[model samples]
Target: MFPKLDPILHSELRLAVMSILAGVESAEFSYIKKQTGATSGNLSVQIDKLSAAGYISVEKGFKGKVPCTTCKITPAGLAAFENYVNSLKEYLI
Candidate 1:
């Protein structure tokens, strides 16, 4: 039997966000939005979910006068992502 996938990272948008963070030290909200082609409102909601799950850390600050939100994956998140990938591989066998 295949291992269960993480419901939080299962979302396409949330998965996309995690995938992006998995490769980098961090990413700005706008960059994630641009890469995922997601609207600000939707992205914010998804980000909140990830943050609430302790899968990602969000920092709200400012680039000069403009507000900025940055996200980074936590160790727990990386483990979860790796586990998710391995579990998904079970389906291919």
Candidate 2:
């Protein structure tokens, strides 16, 4: 039987965000936007969804007069991502 995939992490953009966050302690919104090639509007929507799901944390602040938004994966998010990958491996092997 195939393991169920995480709906929260199932999205292409959301998954990309998670993958990026998994490697770093935190990342800025602009960086994620650039890497995922998602428009600011769409990225914001997805970020909100992930934040609502408790998979990621969004922080907004100012960096030397410039507004900045940063995101980090939560422990729960990391676990979910790991499970998702392992489940995929089952199918690939």
Model 1, which residues run further than 4 Å from truth? none
Residue 88 deviation, candidate 2, in Å? Answer: 0.9
**TM-scores for all candidates?**
0.98, 0.95
Q: Give the C-alpha miss distance for residue 52 in model 2, angstroms.
A: 0.9
Error of 1 at 68 (Å): 0.5
| lDDT of the candidates, in the order given | 0.95, 0.93
Candidate 2, residues 10-88, lDDT tens digits: the string is 8899999999999999999999999999999999999999999999999999999999999999998888889999988
- The number of residue pairs in model 1 that clash at the backbone is 0
> Highest lDDT, which number?
1
Clashing pairs in 1: none
For candidate 1, what is the lDDT? 0.95
Summed backbone clashes in each candidate are 0, 0
Error of 2 at 75 (Å): 0.5
